[model samples]
Target: MAGTNLKCRECATTYELEPRYVCEQCFGPLEVAYDHSRFVDDVGALRRRIQGGPQNIWRYGDFLPLDGPPGPALRSASRVGLPAGCTPLLRADRLAERVGLGEVWVKNDAHNPTHSFKDRVVAVASQRARELGFDTLACASTGNLANAVAAQAAALGLPSYVFIPSDLEEQKILATGVYGTNLVKVRGNYDDVNRLCTELSGEREGWAFVNVNMRPYYAEGSKTLSYEIAEQLGWATPDRVVAPIASGSLFTKIAKGFEEWLELGLIEGSVPTMNGAQAVGCSPVAQAFDAGADVCRPVKPDTIAKSLAIGNPADGPYALELARRTGGAIDAVDDDEIRAGIRLLAETTGIFTETAGGVTTATLAKLAARGDIGADEKVVIVITGDGLKTLDAVRDTFESYEIEPRLEAFEAAVEQGVHV
Candidate 1:
């Protein structure tokens, strides 16, 4: 309700709040613009208001792009669907020591309703769709978004369709299909699936494509992660943030969230040093960043991190700008390092993450090894999804000894150094 208009990120041209993601003039991406002047008068009151609201993302409804006032009524209606956000911000002492960092925290977003951060975006987008009088919910996903969209649509009792690459992980496919959505598996990569959805969105009226037509509002959902992180940290910002990049929306929006709060005098710090992580197999953003280029060159993905396999990220240019401006860098890691990253995080923090998080953890370790992060910097690595979604990534990573149910056999196995 507080959103004023949809403004072009490049041209600054504005349009009435509609389900539009591209500017008609420059064809640049569009995003939700808000009027925060009302909350500037009393910072304490605003903080109290947010703290006293719902325990989910709706608590920051003043910052979201909804068309209605955020309160008990709105939250009650939203509760019928999967309420997202309010995930834990855990301090990982062992993880920090293992990575050679002085202080490290884990924003474990895998604890969301769909076991991924995609639930945050879909919650906002689907609510906006209902407000706009859309009949059906739809999206094009690599994996996690499919599960989020399907589950959210089912909760809202709406007919939904989810399109994903046919080669996506079977665990993610099964998780999505269980929600009773019309799952369309196309024989292509994530880019191909996205292109097809863009075309379909144009032809299908009354169907709200969450990530296509409704993207401007959808992307705003990621800002809640920043809000939560800041709120959880006693209204302060971390020294650095290490997060994965897919469409680059989540990476850039997290910075935007911190910026918005800092500008409003709500949080006490500049935007964190924003380090982005990527799988080397599909890391166009990292390549562009490393080469000092302003534009990203698309590539065919060949990584196990399917959730982050978007080669031509829509926000690639913006992600590069943020990483450089904040004295941060976007780095890539190989598949071997990614698997090792998963194991490292699990062994240290007891949090098993999907490949996207693995990419982030690996990049953090790489940064630590290369002396990119200072010893005293308070770093937060965002784990976006649960490991169960991409179970194959850890299939052969660790040894599992199968011996008869006997103490002698177990002792012998331990003697052979199998247990450790």
Candidate 2:
């Protein structure tokens, strides 16, 4: 594990791993690099390390680029990231059969502390924010990130400042507010809030922006989803997987996870076909991928999935390439289709996922109908957040079966097979 360096993904130029994310030589992105040999002959050793470590993301610290593991004082007080990795990998047999797939898995990340996958990224970002000598945490969020930043900061006793669109769901805003963040609701959409945060980061001082400055590290947390999936599957990959894309980072990182695990000899399997879902209302990434563009064009946000409403994704270009390289596609479904997706998953899996989850499940049905998911390919669908955050999106899907609280009414309904 010695001589670890940060290497430019573009030019292969290496540098001492420091508090930097971009390449100095080629201006390309710099990513954490390691001696692959460390993982070459120690799968059992690594497995033991993970089993012995705390039940959080730290179990995969060897794969992480931490300068060194954080101290106990900081780790103990960390409110957000108490090693929040091991999400359930349900067989999803009933759901898969209903969706017409062979073998299906649901990576239910809603079990995290903050009830969303954002907790994984925020945990890493919060740790790095501390290590980088910052006392305040801030972010430009759609919904989930705002809540995660506030919750993580509160857990660590770090002051938090957050910004988001004014039109965000009441539940999300309240979630962050309850954590005592200096929350600012911008008048426009998510993109507007992001622009303001970017400007603030440039003009302001003494603040750590989770989605910006600490972003590279924050994004790395998404890779843990892949790591857990493979480990839970007994060190193998699924045939295909569907993810909900907003900034497009999640889809790309999940792919990177499989690649790194393979390179480390931690898992032996082919990479999953990584398709992504987006709302048709705001799908610049999907549009760019469909149009064969190298970059995603930013657009106005207008989707029920507020958490997945980043019109201008920082990782959109990389995401498109990942989908294409893996023989997958990024597709967008309409509001109706998205709502249907949510209902379908809830009825079949007994899991109430947010709009993004609906996007994934609905798109799974769409792809299955078009024969994108063959009858025998093993599929995994990621459910990132709890549905309670956006109840309004699916509140109308059910018909009112209201009746008087009487035995005659109940009998009438029962005679109509309503109870069944």
Candidate 3:
């Protein structure tokens, strides 16, 4: 287990690390807790080891629940999983200018193999599933996760079952089905599909539902994003980070990652402000934060950001606590604002992010406008998925000029502010 154990988030009890995500004693969420001493005796040694390891998430194998670093045999594309992580952290000077921030950067996870941040989580879960003797993989996804799990399972030669809302983007559905998995389209939202998957976990033997059963390991994948940010910034933490909130796991895990690095003396700065973004149509976590309450009130999703439409966010309370404790805030934006955000980012930074990214970007702008974000503070916005997957959200929002293929027609369109 690499000296890692599963510990209850609410209770102080710990158990052996396994394919477990819920505590048997208190039923609280189980998280991977590590014995940090095993990974390093000193900060310099840890840095060297991590720097010398694999370029992907495996570089931090010492912190993960893996048996060891992935062997050389598992390095290529022909193997079980494609290398995920170490995505670019771009300096968005133009985006910063547009968003009214002194400095802004983007940890663009759209570059991942599945074109979403879900690839990182799925990679860890799939590897651990193999170790735990599970030959099949399954998940209830929004869109990005469906693509990641299905593609990863196909890569590993595992039969997979992926459940999703029937109304997800066609690009995402096509992407998942092409991976050759048993793609099941449920006629409900993500939470509904998730509930059904939980029921099936008990009935279906020898199947690993990545998000439902292997969540502890799966969620740990998000910590790698924080690690990459710190390393990419020359081993320093940012002043603030804005992340989209769906199930709230990513935002909380990012806070966890920063804490872990600070504990290990890898980074010296105080924890950054942990802000969250959500669509107004499904902003339970944001609403709870605004009300100064711990309990998130669920609402049926009615937003174009289907990826962030988790009405009942699983880690809502934890995310709310982190935001409050870190002196940060959570905010929500409407669908029109989210669309504007998508165009703003692509126009300013040339990063075509999906609706989740739109939520984060739009919320960041709102925060900046409200003077919540300091003009000199360094900020990083996490872009979780690619815009290509959700083209429907912005298809009618744009126009293509049907003009004659002549220089005079182009000049007239350009002069009249028409599409050229």
In TM-score terms, which candidate is top? 1
Query: What do the candidate models score in CA lDDT, each in turn?
Result: 0.94, 0.83, 0.90
Model 3 residue 215 lDDT?
91
Model 3 C-alpha lDDT per residue in residues 202-276, reported as the tens digit of each score: 888889999989999999999999999999998889999999999999999998888988987888787899999
Q: lDDT for model 2, please.
A: 0.83
lDDT of 3: 0.90
Instruction: Name the runs in model 2 displaced over 4 angstroms.
Output: 1-5, 12-16, 22-27, 70-75, 78-82, 413-420
Q: lDDT: which candidate is best?
A: 1
**Candidate 1 vs 3: which has more TM-score:** 1
Q: Which stretches of candidate 1 lie over 4 Å from their true place?
A: 73-79, 418-420
- Over 233-270, each residue of candidate 2 has an lDDT whose tens digit, in order, gives 98888889899999888998999889988877778778
Candidate 1 TM-score versus the reference: 0.97
- The worst-scoring run of ten residues by lDDT in candidate 2 lies at 71-80
Q: Candidates' TM-scores?
A: 0.97, 0.93, 0.97
Off by over 4 Å in 3: 76-80, 417-420
Instruction: Give the candidate order by descending lDDT.
Output: 1, 3, 2
Error of 2 at 248 (Å): 1.1
